[model samples]
Structures are given as structure tokens and as C-alpha cells.
Target: DQQVKQNSPSLSVQEGRISILNCDYTNSMFDYFLWYKKYPAEGPTFLISISSIKDKNEDGRFTVFLNKSAKHLSLHIVPSQPGDSAVYFCAARGYTGKLIFGQGTTLQVKP
Candidate 1:
């Protein structure tokens, strides 16, 4: 039962504002966490990731935090821009290289 859940199906934010996306998992064996941004009809691209041993990871305007104890994680984008509007997927490696992904969160950044 590998289930990654993104409670919000969508989110909207104005440009230059902060955007936050949340994800939760029920599986305790997942050790790697990854966030991917996807555009229509295209494959998802890796944005940020954090290992189970770490608490936080950041790159540029994107940051991801993981809480192993709570089985929860979140992604934050500071000063989000219009280009940041996309479907964000939180995934975790399961039994193999296959990843378990949430339904996805559509972030609409208003111009």
C-alpha cells in the first residue's frame, strides 16, 4: 500500500507571493522523497528532493522539507512567478525504481 496524498487538487497564487504545497504518505519504508514539476503532455522534471536522513533541502526559489516522524512533506516557492504555474507531483521510491506519486497539485500563478 504505497500511497502519496496531496489533499489539495489545486492552488492559486499571485505572482511574487509565496506558494506552498503539501503532501503526506502512509508508508514508513519510503526513504527518498522527490518533487517533480510537470507541464501539459510533458514528462515531469525533478525539482527538489530530500533523503529520509535529512530534514530539509533547498535550491534557488524552491525548498522541500521532510518530516519522517509525521510522514509528511511540503514544498515552498518564494516570490513565485507566473512561470512557476504547473502541476507539482510528490513522489517516493517504492519497492523498485518505480515511484509512487500523488494525484498532483496544480499551482496557478497569476500574472
Candidate 2:
């Protein structure tokens, strides 16, 4: 039920600034961490991910960090743009690729 949690419900940031989103999980069995971005009328899309063996992973302007010991993870977006405004969801995948999702955090980037 509460295996995954997003402490923040929403966040606002100026365009071209950085946006940080946080997530925590209670299940240590999760080995794969992923961040998904969703627009209001569309399904969520995969953004970034990090494996449990690695503490951090980066792709272009996005980065995902995982702390296995603390059961915490975070997504970072650098130079955030208006197009980046959306709901972000943190998800965990086990070895089988089954995902458990946290309550989404809505991000708003002002132009």
C-alpha cells in the first residue's frame, strides 16, 4: 500500500532552472528505479532510471539517483523548460520488471 511515497505533491520552478523531485520506498526488494513523466491527457512516459547497483545515472539533462540503504531516490532536471511541466511518478521494478508506483508529484515550470 505505502511501499512507495512521494513526499511532495507539487513543485514550481522558473524556466531554465533546476527541478528536483524526491521519492522513497519501503520495499528493499526493488532493484530497478525509474522516473516517469506524464502530461494530463497522456499516459506516463519513461524519463530516467538507475539500477540498485549504481548510485547515480544520467541522461542528457536528466539524472536519477538511488540510495539503497536509505530506500530513497531522486530525479533531477537541469535547466527546466516549460515543456517539462508535467506530473512525475517514481516507480520501482523488481527483477521481473513489475513496477510499483508512488503518488505522482506535479511539476510546473514557468516561462
Candidate 3:
């Protein structure tokens, strides 16, 4: 079963603007959330993460928010840049290091 879901297959944003990526999960066992960006033919690179105990976490231009009640989460990138263009995957980790990932959302940042 797909524990995680990314409803939007793609997202577009202009440079220097906010780019929001969304994710939803049906499993409540997840205690941590993470976001990863993958370039074409390349491995996914870790971006940012948030804990289930917290509502939000921010690092530099990236922010991650978790809503336990809704079983939802989101990643926000402020001042999006062309270099930020890639496929982003939302992931959740259970007690173990095992992670469940949503269908990736391709983000295109216009220059």
C-alpha cells in the first residue's frame, strides 16, 4: 500500500518566489518526515526534515511543516531558484530507519 501521496505531479514557480510542495500520509506510525530532491539520473539528495513532535522546522531557504491531525506535511522553498528545479519526494520514517516515499513532484523554477 502507498503510505504517502503527493497529489500534485508537478509544481511551477518563478525565481525569487515561494514554492510549496505538499504531501499526505495514511499511516500514523511515522514519527519523522523528510524531503529529498533528485536530479535526472541521480540519487536523491536530502533536503530538510521535521519531527512529529514539532509543528515546523526551518533551515535556510527551506521549511517543513507537519500536521499530525491531518496526517499531512509540506515543504516550502522561499525565493526559489532555477537550481532548485528537480523532482522532490516526501518521505516518512517509522521507528526504524526505513522510509516510505510519495510519488515525486517535479518542480520547475522559471528564471
**Pairs that collide, model 3:** none
Ordered by lDDT, highest first, the candidates read: 3, 2, 1
Worst 10 residues of 3 by lDDT: 92-101
lDDT of 2 by residue, 7-111 (tens): 999999999999999999998888899999999889999998898899999999999988888999999999999999999999999877679999999999999
What is candidate 3's local distance difference test score? 0.96
Error of 2 at 77 (Å): 0.4
Q: Model 3, 1-111: lDDT tens per residue?
A: 899999999999999999999999998889899999999999999999999999999999999999899999999999899999999999999987789999999999999
Q: Can you list the residue pairs that collide in candidate 1?
A: none
Compute each candidate's TM-score over C-alphas: 0.94, 0.96, 0.97
Best by lDDT: 3
Candidate 1 Cα lDDT to native: 0.93
lDDT of 2: 0.94
Winning candidate number (TM-score): 3
RMSD of each: 1.3, 0.9, 0.8
